[model samples]
Target: MIFCTYTSLVSVTHTTVVDAPILEVYSSLYQKYGTKLTCPCTNIAIAQRDFITLIPTFHQVCYSDFVKKSWLSYLNAASDKYLSSDFRSQGGLLFQILASFCRLSQDTIKNSLNKFYSTRFISNDVLDEDLLKNQSRSHIETYKSTTAREFVNSFNNIRDAISGNQLLSGFLTNFDFKPSKYSSEPQAYLVSYVSTVYNMPGRCNCDDTPSCIFPASINDNNTGHVILVVPGLYTGCLLVEAMRQSNLQCLYNQTCLNEIKKHIRSSVSFNSTALSSFVPSRYNASTDINQLLTELMVESWIENISHASYYNRCQPAHCVYTIVGKNNAIYIITALLSLLGGLCKVLYFLTLIVVKIIRRRRGKIVSIKFLVGMSEIYSILTL
Candidate 1:
């Protein structure tokens, strides 16, 4: 009987932004070792991790937008194919993308196999063999043999789970905040103040004065605030006073474009000037963001597969050899028949020997009886 251990999926709540240049490095590594990166489950896990890392960096930038749009388009186009057939297909684009982004460690893959299953499920001993040649085909069946369907099923499950999770909303919230300052000052003056304070460099030798030099008359004005955003299961946003003080206080607040406009209006002298001239803080409310998040979550589902003790138990063998036939029932029946035949032959030979001995003894007994009767008759005639 096969024994498997139950292992929980790895919890990945924290995320960090990985820049494009660094991702390119990982992509290069994947290309170099694509053949060695076997195991669909492990590949999926790594892909998920990569998506989790990349999704947070999505912004209004052209590259980010391109990635988001391209991926979504690919998904839509491949929807029918993905649903109908094995996911490892699609010109191997998904696999390539996943492989390019996630670098799988050999050790981690080796450790993820189930120990008991690994020892007994010996298909073929091709551990040192090159996998590149085998994986060249687009179809999953051409490569994975018995495991092709399983891999496809796992991929689907992950995709479904990610879609169900709705990860984007989980990580994001509506940006809302109260106005910090209101004034009747000129637009240029207000814009200058906001820009100057926002772009101020760190102080070298700090004094009791605030880092941002404000006008003396600005005592009546409200000091601006700094917003801190960090990535996590639930992304956290903290607002802190912009002014430097001995004890810093953080105000729990949400970011809103309207609040920013109000703050700019309060600080500006003109009432009619629109804040549209300045770039508004970009909020990610796009459906593309949801798609990206779902994709990432789907990819991350592979993490559970990679870490699962079942998959980790043993590396799948590429070949199998046996002295007996492949069919267990046939081999067992043949073996039993051979054993029974041998036993029957041995018994038949023993029986033949016993019959010969018994026949020889009976002949001897008859001869002895005849000789005794003849001797007795001769003695009686002589008398």
Candidate 2:
């Protein structure tokens, strides 16, 4: 009789909360301070610096206006749904602004710098020192003129591009600053919350005490749910769920069953001694693919835990240390210590009661004997 087992696919989900509002946290220093700002996003700092240095005319003429307009655009973009999907738009605005600068740099290198540098040393055989000096000076002057013209042209192109691009236009529009509903008073308390999901598959064995019970029919599907609550992220908690699959076919398709089978086969073939002994005797090659796939998926999910990066829009400096009035660890520790002090007082009182009882017993013996003797003497004198 051919026996088969089926397993369902599992689904997982997670959410993370941060202490600061998404908008203020992710914005670049340049967007916040303009010409007065230095780039805080290190990944794009070089491009930003190039843009600043090359576009001298823009800085002189339209820099202030650009900063104001971009800041407003950023606020509007925050209200859009797309913000949530892309880590609250970190470096998004800077990317848009720098796009034009990149394009200009590419053009300059291609059309002018490359041509000039290629030909500058082409006639290196000239022996005349005076001629070489004059020619070098001329080349340098020509290079400067070419770059100057390119810079002005690039600025114009960007300005014109801004007028037509809807996203850019919106970003460049001058609008008044209004705080988002998500925004809190800078001093308000905030907490970060994060969530993630994982899946685990059942194992099959044909032994009397098999790891998993095999159903009579291949159509039977079993499912299980697990919830894990863990403390994480600066006084916050994380919840993870491992969900069981209900449909065998659905699980197989979602997790790429065939790929997993091929990989397992390849691994076993390459490392026969190491893996051959571990293969289960009851494991039906065909029926066990579902189980193997589930195991693989669960392992991959677990491995992803170390690689996960939480979406945080807050500035690295202020966000790391900022806490609401008193919800922080320092206050919590103080409260715990106060409770411990009260417990110590109770313990001290119990010790005092025990000591007094022992002392009273000893004193009572002596006092009672003395009292009896005094009573006898008084009776004798009266008789």
Candidate 3:
């Protein structure tokens, strides 16, 4: 399960148009939460702990938006200069972006796996095999084969549990807050924030028109539901502004545009239905902010867990080292020592056997007392 922990701005904006004023909600949030709500990485030490703990799950992890953005910027720069970027072509671009960015972070990618997952879950043998791989793709896939798929499958079960009518009943009883406690507003401005650090080719702009040309088969009904989830209020406004700034007025030829409109209408219809399911509650911005924080925290936790698991499986360099790091180093030394010790023992035994055979060949009467005395002497010499 890809647990995305984007800024809470995405969720807040994605709702249908609310009956209450938008500023009211914003005011409530700032008053109650304000800057107090920051990324959980506020404390460097805690962040490190979280990083170490979650390293095993993400084979291909990107810790900072800065790194992913840098790669994206480089790809775009190459494209603008008509130069062969790290990704030679459109296909290459997608693969590189996914390999480099995606879920796994750079810091985690750099460290040894054994250190992250702990020795209990991994061993020396596995670490050696993992570090042997050169490319990021192999590392990512290996991790998935080991970790991601299983965790996602389990998360699916949790999601399924919350899907049916049993969700509200159980949620209300167990949790401190409920979605129903919010304002009785019928509409939410539904927005969806796609990851901004996109390195895909042919993705020059996010204009509604450019979206029409995307190669992914667009369901005629699905086209209109393209809710752009921006990272922040400023970003959202910038997105719309960029659409206007870019002379990309003609969305994917006229035919694609028509299809896109159809998709948008269908999406609106779907959102209307989805929005209707939950009972509306009285609006209290502070309460809503709290709820949003809760949702973000849960998402961050899940993403961290799933990503760490994937890393362990992916063995993206650092992950493999985390496992066998100290133990593997020690194991190699131990093996050498054992081999040497065994060799000495074997040599001592061979020496004794040779001495006895020589005495026998000399026709000497090898009495039991003589043999016993010889054996004792050999043992002392060997020790």
Candidate 4:
């Protein structure tokens, strides 16, 4: 069995409750500010950017507003209860109220910047840059990476819930507040949700173990169902945005490709027989007729004199027809001398025949045996 210990760490469960009704809050965030307006950070309008940014800002702003309103109201409610009744009687309740106040205060501050990003006359780009810096600073101050991530994650959750209506349905419980069946399932990033939240950067790797098992929810609403609905989209668009930046493409491809190259390099091996089949050539001065003929018989170059093989291999063929060597010159001289000797023998035979014919015409008897002897001598001369 392949035990996946890392898989256990994925899809972290988080729950938070706002004082307002969940549907009303969801609608206020999603419906009201979903339209593209002028950016708070820049002079350019929201229409110039992408549609994904538009809706998420809605959720961010709404959540931020909710944080402020809910926490204050919760505090006021606690104050009235404590002041109206005896403090001694309600001291235990006071602790609970104070604890709620602390939790909501932190949540409110986080939400405030996010809300501001979606609103008013400033540039979205500046707001985003500021938010990242703020988050980083907060992370340093708190010395808690997980909480720091949560601060951004909450806003990201809202982004996902809006982009994937199915995800919103899964994350948000019915008015009766029944836990969804998938609530126990792990949290993973959603492609469309992440695209909307992060401007369609790199893809989500939901199957990645351990990190995938965390329970996903928006504002800690419907954990499991929400993850299943939207996949890997994180809050704040930080991870996706970083990946989309041009400088990191090489690193991104390298990380994924290195594994394949490693397996190939490891499996390869050299074979001695394959190497031994090829040998380097050495020049030979001595020429043996038998060896030359044997080599010519088997050699592809000699057989492919018309250079058919050169075309097959996509090369230009230019054969050298001249032979230059001491022994080669001797053979050429011998052939030339032999041709002259044969011509001389033929001329001497013709002269002798004419002389015999002339003598026979003058009434002298010609000797057939003598003629035959002369013919044999000419043949020898020809050789």
Candidate 5:
């Protein structure tokens, strides 16, 4: 027993606080402590901008001449242009929708930023950089996914009402049809109205759905009943539908741009520059406008996050942890002496109890033997 030494474990805690720039603090704490260290934050509420940065790269169509007023108005004023999908009569509406889409996409993203910032964030800890990034990414993706789904439903409603119902036809009912500078005959105005508004003659009259409106060329206003399907551009029941399905793939080629440039009323030469699909974008040149709209017309989204910023915002008061430690020589010696004292008291009590029990049993045996001897002596005396 003298050769052996008594050992005991003592729990000890070490705490340290580093004062540095946000990025440096995060790097140092993460590298040194791994997960063993923790610091409770003095302030937990942090602005989202401190931890998250997101930038959306919009599609080239939004910036191209297609959406610009100069190009659209030029196409609209072309006297020789007869294709409605060429941005002639409905150019204003097309421009309106495109402009609205661009503005609304940005506004929605702004709202998302503000809304996310409004929420509370604990940061959990300073070293939880991965956790913070994942949260921000998830938040952005959720907004994008929700916006895409909602846009699809809303656009479908508009398309359905324009083609299958009389929802939009009522707006033109009160307007007087008159002769335009393009044509002296007021009847030409009527023909244009039916073609542009109803998409086809008698298309305005519908309980559930009107007749299908195919693309047509307006060589002469007198031929209202005739349907002409124009080549090189798409046209359907509504111009909006055509635009949604359209892409600038043709403008990429020299020949296609040349043919289309014939109708453009620009005095200057219109470049055949195409929308670039080579950039790091989720969509390609031939991707439909509707598909692009699903992504808010954003070619790409870039996110930048810094854990140092998060740690600074957290501003932990202290780092707290426990360490497994062996007792010192003095403490071990004291504990060993106390253990020996307790063991001695316990053994003494046990020995006293055994002796007492043995004495009581021996007295009982002697009493029984004495009673038997007395009985035997009485029986012998009587004999």
Candidate 6:
């Protein structure tokens, strides 16, 4: 009975063969067990690149001719008298900064990926689509936002460091500290004013006055040559401010390009094609460099999650579940019947033993009484 009960009441594990696509099986498993069940992976050290893909797009300027040696060389060789002459050196510097920003953005994203694969993922551990997607998004946004802030702060520091009023520029071009008659003003005053406006944005300090900047003439008009002023370019107190405040729409306008080409001695080498907004890009032609810098100059990025690969890596042999024996009607009835048969057999054997003992005792007592009666009769006859 004890053996029968033990066999009947024991719990069992059931395995159900999954007969669906791998992705479907994975989804079903997640739905049933969530993260609680462990699916051991055949390839435990799965590379993140196998399951995730990332592609980044950088600022258009980084891809444009402005940063190319051919274009800068052409600018240098072209007539210095043209309005866009300053573009030869200043444009180079600006785009260099842009290229640097793009590199840092790429590096930061790479590090984030490394960190993700190194720390976040456990290959054999069960994973769900939502969990993976959310994790990817979190890492991307965290790195992007953090790097963007840092990139912008770096520019701000550069901006503040070169102000015409306070920093190196101020020392070079001193302001008139005291009131003086216009006639009595020293030649230094004229030199200071001209130098202030002539250097970069030349007009005002961006920190003290938001509207202090204006488009610098393409050519130095102070050189007594006729200044050629481009339509959309400006020079601010700092090169960064100039990029932020100025619009690049002129670079996208055909007429503007034509005007710039006409001023240059050679039109053949000049980049006559306007900036294209049609090319799949995150930023438009009018988006200024300030916004570009703040965004770390990334035009776009691609994210892909491969559930198939994940499933393949975590290929489960079968689904296993345990069923407890309690409250099961069939098991209960079978166990009870087995216990009843065992108990009846035991009771019958006990009854047989008890009957044998009673029969033996009764026989012995009868015999003893018979012997005593005979002896008494024999004594009476002798007397």
Model 3 C-alpha lDDT per residue in residues 115-183, reported as the tens digit of each score: 333423322222122232332334334543444344334434543454332222211211123233333
Candidate 2 lDDT, tens digit per residue, 1-383? 01111111222232222333343433332244333322122121111111111211111111222224443354234333332211112223432333333344445544654455344232311112344346555655566566656555544464445323311113211111343345356654454321111111244221111112212111111232212111110000000000011112221232332322222212112111111223223322233222322221111110111100111211222222121232345545565677678879998999999899989998999999999999999999999
In model 2, the runs with Cα more than 4 Å from the true position are 1-90, 99-103, 117-127, 157-383
In model 5, the Cα lDDT at residue 100 comes to 71
lDDT of 5 by residue, 1-383 (tens): 54124364545454556543355555566666667656667676777777777788887767776666666556455543333333334444544556677777777777876776665665555556776778777876886798677766777887676654444332232122354446455433433233333434345433334233334232334554433323324444444555566555664455555555554455444355555556566666567677777887787878887777677778876665444466677777787889889989999999999999999999999999999999999999999
Clashes of 1: 22
RMSD of each: 24.5, 38.8, 31.8, 40.2, 9.4, 7.1
TM-score, cand. 4: 0.17
Task: Compose the digit string of candidate 4's lDDT tens values, residues 281-372.
Answer: 12121222122222211111111011121112222122111222233444545655676688699989998998888878754335766788
- Runs in model 6 deviating more than 4 A are 1-36, 40-50, 79-124, 161-203, 206-212, 219-232, 266-268, 307-337, 353-383
Preferred candidate (lDDT higher): 1 or 5: 5
Error of 3 at 233 (Å): 28
What are the lDDT scores of the predictions, listed in order? 0.29, 0.31, 0.31, 0.30, 0.60, 0.60
What are the per-residue Cα lDDT tens digits for candidate 1 across 8-77? Answer: 2222232222232222333343464443422222122222221111112222221222123343343344
lDDT of 4 at 125: 23
Let me know the TM-score candidate 2 reaches against the reference structure: 0.20
272 in model 3: Cα distance from truth in Å?
A: 23
TM-score of 5: 0.63
Which residue pairs of candidate 5 clash?
A: 216-228
Give TM per candidate.
0.26, 0.20, 0.17, 0.17, 0.63, 0.63
Task: Give candidate 4 misplaced runs (Cα > 4 Å).
Answer: 1-238, 246-332, 364-383
How accurate locally is residue 281 in candidate 2, as Cα lDDT from 0 to 100?
A: 31
For model 1, state the Cα shift of residue 302 in Å.
15
Name model 5 segments beyond 4 Å from true: 1-29, 79-96, 157-165, 169-233, 264-272, 325-383
